[model samples]
Target chain A: MRDIYAPRIHGIDTSEIRKVFDLAAKIQNPLNLSIGQPDFPVPAAVKEAMIQALTDNKTGYTPTAGLVQLREAISTYLKPKIGFETEPDNVIVSTGVASILFLLFQTLVAKDDAVLLLDPYFLIYPALVKYHEAQQYTIPESFDEADVNSLNDRLKKDGKKLKLIIFASPSNPTGKILSETQLRLLSNLADEHDAVIASDEIYEAFDYEKRHVSMAKLSPHRTLTLNGFSKSHAMTGLRVGYLAAPPAYAGIVQKMVTLQQYTMVCSPHAMQWGAITALKTGIDAELSVMRKRRDLVYGILSKVTKLPYPDGAFYVYPDVPIDSADFVTRAIERRLLLVPGYIFSANRNSIRISYATREDILEEGAGIFCDMVRELG
Target chain B: MRDIYAPRIHGIDTSEIRKVFDLAAKIQNPLNLSIGQPDFPVPAAVKEAMIQALTDNKTGYTPTAGLVQLREAISTYLKPKIGFETEPDNVIVSTGVASILFLLFQTLVAKDDAVLLLDPYFLIYPALVKYHEAQQYTIPESFDEADVNSLNDRLKKDGKKLKLIIFASPSNPTGKILSETQLRLLSNLADEHDAVIASDEIYEAFDYEKRHVSMAKLSPHRTLTLNGFSKSHAMTGLRVGYLAAPPAYAGIVQKMVTLQQYTMVCSPHAMQWGAITALKTGIDAELSVMRKRRDLVYGILSKVTKLPYPDGAFYVYPDVPIDSADFVTRAIERRLLLVPGYIFSANRNSIRISYATREDILEEGAGIFCDMVRELG
Candidate 1:
């Protein structure tokens, strides 16, 4: 048979996280720390809201953008938190932050477009850029003032102009939240290069050390803030998320909504009702629990390997002494599932451990990881 | 500000159906015959299943392709109806059929690839092809043996090679189900052109005349059957759908699943559990109600306009005497929402009336449509 797929299909190879999931599925009760979603059950109130919506016959399609109440609720929720007065018009509710990101890329990024990335980023960033045939440039050194200047110099030297810059803070694998000063510098870089900043704030609620800041706050004129309830309220399966565009990008947001109409049609209708309830519900208690888990995991893993102290999100990326792929393979053999750092960065000396699991599992998984590092080191 | 969007964004213009929706939103208690979804509430069993799933805390992410049991249920459901033995591996559950179509087109169709669209098609087809920069060829004459032959000749004359053929049976506007002979002929054409068949069977349950024949039944080697519970079980808001690929297209299915992983991630998880229950439930009673509504609608409209006899789905496309857009405008003035035929086809002399609303509303809407036709004609 003829090859019935486009060339772009080859670029979107399955991520290593999926491989970890596939491997974990075979092992009985593996001490799993490779998952990215929160392990907490959805709050009772949110579940009841969705149930009520279903019972009320809200099972038909909502407007393509989403339910009006949900959009308004999202706007109200973000106004205080995102440090901006947002209106319902600025929001486009989607299946998840992942889906919104997909639409954003499809709408904005094109062939040969320069998409800048931070090292050890969300695994989807490179794949999305590659899928669009965009030119990808990553700052692999470190996230610092010096690194921003180095990135600017490298771009100028290579004669590359950045079209889009994507980063998740409190990032997925690293859980390192960028400082306000760092955000300002990157925002300035975006202004200099005339690029759009896609700030993935899905982990916004997970900041442990300080208050969470959004790129939407630092550079509202050019930043697209991506967030969802999956992690914060533990509603990953509901697949509801939204992207908030600044007033300057309302036209572009409209275009993304149109694309979404042809693609997702709309997010699940009943779930949007649940999301409305979630906006009013706080996760402070849950955040405290995760904060302790983060402290415990980092405390254990740091004993054997050098890694950055994660301040946000639920993951810690540790620089292992042995090959990270080999380290993960050995960990799998020990009935522990962990993702290698190559999935997030070109570098292969580290592994990402998500502390989103229960405390006992996180503790046991971290111990197993440290033991493996010592044996292989 | 710089134009922060790709050129492809311009190709996906918002459809006229959305315009109708916007206009209808402004009207109070409009006799609505413009919506595509079934008006029936989601079945009680399905709703309870989703509620149960939520209560059981299946609110975390499922595997990207969807829950294993849902995939298995989908396979089992299709095996007898599609005239082929299906396995769970051949299925990929997605957010909706529209979403699966998006992934399928993104995975397979590339720029300049020729896509064959049946005329008066679902509005999304042309937009999807245009967004991909694919060359689109439509058979706008009629749906019959002659039209298929004419399409083959036209393709040859234009020196165009067909890469894909997309059609919905028990189609949206026309509600005309393709006969088994027609399916066999189109399958032969697909074989001749070496094109893949995307049989959109979302309205499979809406067939009232004869057994709905799927292209998959005739051309399993090169067919991708797209179906969902949205229309059948009235779970449109739940956004759960699946694609069944033939054994020959397993590799392509895997690629689409990967694309979906980076995009939709998975269908709303709890909804998939509901879908599993939906597969075991019957919608024959509700389908019968729609069948009678179809008869009521066609009977009234045929008195004033020329249209094909609709045997399935919930819509009837009638050729109106006045400009179809103007007719829709006039209808809106009278608080009757109808979609212009040009929204679905190049021809502008017809309009689509959905009988998916209540029978009284359908009757009143049909009467209003006839009165307007007589006055304008």
Candidate 2:
């Protein structure tokens, strides 16, 4: 009976982050800092566009790639922002950025093909590779001098088998943005190795320090830019995202589209209309609010705890006084929901607190989290 | 450069059906008929529910499996319909039936494993198996008693390796429904051999002859029922569907959910609420109109050529006077958009005409199609 399933699906488990979400649902009015999406409701204009699409009966399948107009909109919007030109054909709407990543991996990864991932990375990255029976190699922490040199060594060793490198800007769990120098070094390494980079910039619009730089802007020929409106527009459930690759990868990208044509089809049609509005209106208001919440959390947490300097997205990862899983369990017992960093990383040492909630709740949660760490110490 | 792609994706191209769609879009308002969706708009109640969900600020992620109430709604509705009760946990909501089928095959089909498919089958099924690097053996034409005998021998030869059988009820292209006796034989055969049946019942509500019979109803343990709102509620763009399996395969199904969690997240949340309403309201009115279109197509095509008597769905597959591809091309020149059967079938002789359009358009297109066949003869 156990053998009735596909070989790869054995030993599978639910994401630990999702488990926290489930446990959080049972608690009443806890200061929840464990959310993975923005706390704001979708913008009125975007919601209105979706509503209008429903009224107009735009509830049928769009072209397999996406609505051409939305693809065109994404192309125009991303070009100036990323400092690169793109045709509409380069953009493909997906159910969400999650899906684009999945399809991209499925399209490009073969068994034993290795993809380089930065450790303390997004949890799903390695999982996607594993599902495809691909080998995953991790670079410790950041693309600092040592890590970059290590990458060059690993690429030389793996040669053509090291097919991809994936990382996120304003990365999940830890909201660390990759510096331009680091991205440029990565681009050079990829060129030397003849590999590709999957730059996940879903959090691109949430940047607070320098303006977000797309890796694709620096190395369009070797980058597949994966992005979405879920975070910026507070439209997580709307499932609107796009993947853009340089035309050099069009043949492979088209194969990805063909796989999706039979599987996921296009992204949600009405929500794609909402995304058209999202790109048009921009996410300034939401970003400003997220910035404030981040400031509030940082102001409190940095006082008592060792943490990474917050730059973008909505989370702040801090080293815990206790084991990561234990810290998360204790927080849950105290009616606080914070995710353990080990859920996202290779080690069980830190916890992630999302500041995406309103200022007051995030402030309160931050204070409690700090107090809890102090008490444990 | 082709070497940059994954081994499986190299030979992939756009679906032949999609090729027809691309060519059709270039033509002016000819008697268009190459649709695969209901011509009617989404039900007003369903559309309004989606509107209200959006307005109510339900624009954040639901659980990866789906909204609880929606899953519960599907479970309750399907219990009576499928003759076996399932818990909400057994129903996994997906972006569309397309995504579900993709994940299902990706999860179950091991490389080199052989799965049985009905020829003239839905185009996506074989493509999915191929993409997974699995073997696909097609059963000749339809599933009759002889076909069942052939299936048993194939299963015996392949033994445990031949693990899956996939077919659609109220099938696409031909709109043929499997009789209960045929279904029972398949179910018994599956039980005997420890194989599984993937019952694609996306067109369940559109069945016009006998009440739609679910393959899951007879063999819940070995049947994975795939159904969705896109076909029945005219909500193709809404991207809501479910894969229901028995508790025995919860482990396998959980893996499918994990893949989607890392990839698709969940189906569009607001559209899922519409699906809840879709189940509650049913699709009686839409089914009645489609029945008229089915009858209209049968009346015109039956006179000119040999064709399957379509009992449900919105298509009538008719044998043509020339090669399927040649006939499809010829029809396009005459300003009609008919899909050739080779796009859905193993051979290249018949073409499929969709009657999911207005009566006048169907009549005009059918006449043109018949005249073209006569001219070719």
Best by DockQ: 1
Badly placed stretches (over 4 Å) of model 1 are A140-142, B140-142
Task: Report the TM-score measured on chain A for model 1.
Answer: 0.97
Q: How would you encode candidate 2's per-residue C-alpha lDDT over B24-77 as one tens digit per residue?
A: 988898787888888888988888899999999989999889998998888888
Name the runs in model 2 displaced over 4 angstroms. Answer: A157-161, B157-161
Q: lDDT per residue, candidate 1, A1-377, as tens digits?
A: 78778878888888778888887789987998888888788988999999899889988988888888988888888887668866678789999999999999989998889999989889899999998899889885256778878888988888888999999988888888887888898899899998999999998888897756888888888988889999999988899999888888888789989998888989999999999999998888888999999889888887888987798999899998877888888888889999999888888899998888888888788888888788777
DockQ of 1: 0.85
Clash count list over all predictions: 1, 2
Worst 10 residues of 2 chain B by lDDT: B154-163
Among all candidates shown, the one with the greatest TM-score: 1
Residue A188 displacement in candidate 2 (angstroms):
1.3
Error of 2 at A323 (Å): 2.0
**lDDT for residue A74 in candidate 2, whole number 0-100:** 81
